[model samples]
Target: MTTETAGGPTGPAARPAPHRVVIVGGGVTGLVAARQILRDRPETTVTVLEASERLGGQVLAIDVDGVAVDVGAEAIHLGAPAAADLARALGLDATVIAARRGQSVLLTRRGLRPLPAGVGPTGPTRVGPVLRSGILSWHAIVRAGLEPLTRRRQAADVAVGDFVQGRFGREVTDTFVDPLLGNLHSGDIHRLSLQATAKQLVPVAESGTSLLLRALRKPTPPPRRPDEPAPLPMFASWPGGLGALVDALASSLEGHATVRTAVRVEAIGRTGDTWRVDTGEGPVEADAVVVAVGPRPAAVLLGPHSPATARALEAVDTASVATVVLAYEREAAEQNPVLRDANGLLLNSSQSGVLKAMTNMSRKWPLGHPSWHIVRVSVGRAGSRVAVDLSDAQMIAAASGELATLIGLNATPVFATVVRWPDAMPQLTVGHPGRMAAARAELAGIPGLHLAGSAADGLGLTSTIASGVQVARTLVG
Candidate 1:
């Protein structure tokens, strides 16, 4: 029953062996955790087991028209420091570049209309833009203008949809909030937790101040000093796409940790004070274990060890989304200035179609193929079943038809690729905080066990990385 320590062995004549840690899942969260642990405790043995043959879970890249394009996540919100800090630590700071263009329009029944200028991603900040954009009716505009003067009552938590609807009216919620937040989180705004999604605006809501007044009072930034460098872009990504980040993380773990692909972890249990992980290949014994898989898989693995934690995790729901990338002739896009000018387009929920959003990839980032134009179409949302049930061909057709209707481009694409992510995004409902707190409490009672990922925390890239680093630091300490 005796195990050798890190030094060498447990026998009187041998040195103690190092602590053993096993991480299930090779996605960004698990990879980051392995890297952090190895960096902090070099002598500790770390093993990362991924079911898939590749490392990154949702972050991936593919070739279209002889150019590498991001098929999964493509941007990181610079509002948070976690992603940027990790990039700097990994020596990827120089590779980071902001979006070449920031303008996005909404595809409505009337046609494409610019989203109100100066409007926050989730809602409108200024009334002038909303009025001038012509996206709202005159009545809706008047109601929205009165939002600042409206009285505000604060609650501990509220749904993003309900909060915006009550304060700003239904027009703003449906036209602005739904499409923007839906495209970002891949979930329904009515179910998305306000605190988890838009923590910045909560204070304004609670203060009962006029949103317009507050936004107008927002002071302009002081001029930068001559010696100061330019501020980082609001969003940034790697030149090779987000997949490069995954490759970088894996490369950094070389010589320090063991990484195994195509290894599925069936179950995890504790034996004495040590932990045992059952994989398809064999069983792994470790001093500690980190479960970085999705909530459903994590629930199954923890069910036998901790039913309460399992129940909490199983209660969490997820959404599925599919990305369809189409590469068209550059002439087709050039012929239509709208396609060339738009960085991205968000679909109004009221619009009749399967396509939820479209990103003009070529315009957003240089793909090194000037002769080709790449457009990425996102399908499905929190409550929609269109993407999960449809075949890849059908999805592509739907996307193509929608694109043609939105922009006048009917020529066949030179290349097309579909990436389906089933149950990849976690739905953070209003009561999510309580469930997460309970899960954490249950995990604290179990020794040598940790959980981290988009399911455990919020769905942003920053939150996911921060969760991994936080858990690894706790285990290392």
Candidate 2:
């Protein structure tokens, strides 16, 4: 909402206002940092420069045929302190509801089958349902039972795929975890750090107990505040969609924030005490600069300033991902078995020929409602042999075909939307934390320079928000 020259709020022709702090990247991280900086230090001038004209990076939402289609992140996994704090700060009206975890279908060679209870993303949390389910062979179940007897390999961290395949057998990893947790990371399980990705179940794997017993006896710490309610499915987007959160944060800055679109940051270099940021238009000098882009971009920008940081960032590989949004008539799709669907079913990459997973947006969130009868299908992995290669229309056709087989549907969708994110989700390899620590230490010497993004921490809205808030605290402190 504010416009100013490189001279900033104060120039020789005008009275000086405050210290100028430039925030690069206008995604959630940059916007959050701008808000935090303005709130913490009113004397400081905050500006957000985004390469894209639109903000909210991955938390993007669009209206298609009078229906709200979330092209990016649909769910908010923020629990407790983060969610409550953010909701209050933004004055966002959020509805508390649990994610549709039950009434899911598991696609198999036979047909769409009811998802067996106790078979979580990690493994069977309870043994009864798993034993009864015909999904796994008897031999595979016996192999799973031997997990407690298996020795915990002494390593800093291992790939989730390796660990699961070694302990539970390849069938479990491919059949269940691959489609469930694997899809969560866009199906780059081999590269995904077990420490960062499947940390909740790490202790169970480490303990000399079967996953079922471990899950049952897992010592979950009681809430510090008993009166506070458990977060409802982490948190969902407000009525207007996730974009509402971004718009609210941007508006809160008022005239303080300056968002530059269609301007690519060519390079970032250190100039004595201050850092110089090079853009397509020109260079902007600032006392502080936050590189909040993806890891690959961060590596490119920080190469001159901090080679170690750059290399460290480069160590974290990124995977390309695609999200396909398809719409169908509700009554027409009712005949499909999977379509009796409570929400949507998550498909394992190995089982489903085309899709990694799918979400029934209309059933899950209020934005789409039932009229749209929307479904979101994910495709691709961080790195894998087999891959899905199809244009928007082709991808939709493939997904529709799968739907037809799974649910017995023959009707065509009105229209479909596809969002491709190239090198978006970062693959946090083993020893990721250590590598990040070393990079941070190297960059610590440089004053007025900070790092914040999905690449900095674990990929998620909650983590990205925390990175921005933490960087702001570091600066103010």
Candidate 3:
């Protein structure tokens, strides 16, 4: 093999050879990284190795009643620019649509109550909404109101549950924070890292000001000018489904990179300046390598080369989840007109149910089927065996029963499918930032080696795609 310098050849007699890069794990992160590398350096040759037979790791779409529905990741945060920018770059701007602005209820013991306006994944952003929502008792409300007067400790890291409970009281933490933030990781809020999961709340928490007060003090953005275009929705996705994104990314990389599925990378070794990757089939060499696989698998591959990096990677944990899709005819949905008004519902941890959340797909997006209604029920969470131990039939039955009870639906769905994602979401528990920092620092010493994925950053379309792009730019430089 020949090596080329960054500046290319000094004379015409010697033309610089193309840089060869091999990416492990053909998930969205790996694919995005490959695309960035190819775009930035057209002379670079890229290869993507995936252990599974297909691509798009968690971003998957399945056919339900002749319409494409997303079983895995369904929406992208419009608050973040990475995903939107990438979508536009891929010529998917026209296909992008925002989530319908509809009321989403919370299943409390008292019955279904609207999720207090201004309450978010972290906690209650505005006090007026929480005060009027009646989700908390009068005494709990008083305690939450006194948050601004309370003293807060300045800690580098803390648990989300601990921080929120300390500031807003247990009632708020249990009713609002737990279901919203905890469900995001499919894990307990008490174990999730405050900095890693809810970084937006860090400044508010450490400022010693009441979180609710600060939220109220926040100024609203100015109204759009008459000449300005309409704003995008808070969440956006392709009409076909999120899978369209995966398909587009893969197609864009056709001649620029080679994507090989069903190819598992066993180990990674370094020989002098070049990196050697050993797959199930054979060994391959590359000028640079990007490891975008899950943390555990990445640890296994990097153990021999860097034990410290492996140890750090091992510290990151993951959670499994399953999404059950149910399609109902228009007649079945007509029995419950409320389904048409609301976008979805989230279950409180205190509620007795197998489902953590449910989304009314037909209302949230335009499925183009007026006679059909699609609903997605999510089951299982970190440390929960509801989905792991149950069979497909059991999962479907549980979801069906829950929907019937919640929506008063007696009719059966026209189609039902269960999609299980094992170890799909990474849990960024306390100390995760420090752990990742140490790992990245150690890996930096190894030239031409980079790590990028949800494990390195936080989980979400924005963070994952940004991680891939950042690593790709670093390699290109």
What TM value does model 3 have? 0.91
Output the worst ten-in-a-row residue range by lDDT, candidate 1: 6-15
Q: What overall lDDT goes with each candidate model?
A: 0.80, 0.72, 0.81
- Model 1, position 70: C-alpha lDDT score: 86
Candidate 1 lDDT, 337-383, residue by residue in tens = 65678788887666748788998888888777968889899988777
Relative to the true structure, candidate 1 reaches a TM of 0.91
The TM-score measured for candidate 2 stands at 0.86
Better of 1 and 3 by TM-score: 3
Tens-digit lDDT track of model 3 for 7-104: 22111212246888999988889989988787677678799999999999888888876788988888888667787667767777767788888767
Question: For residues 1-477, could you state the per-residue lDDT of candidate 2 as single tens digits?
Answer: 333332123112122356678888888888788777766665676777888878888888777787667778887765646655775556553444445555567665445666677666665677677677787887888887777676474353778778887777877787777777777777567767777677665675565346645656768777659776445455466665677777777777777567776777889877687778899889988888888889888888886778778877988877787888888887776556566565677676656666767777766666545565778877777674223356777777777777666666778887687888777788887878778888888888888878888787777787788788888777765
Where does candidate 3 clash, by residue pair? 186-382
- Tell me the TM-score of each prediction against the true structure: 0.91, 0.86, 0.91
Which RMSD does model 1 reach against the true structure?
A: 5.2
**lDDT measured at residue 168 in model 2 versus the true structure, 0 to 100:** 79
lDDT top scorer: 3
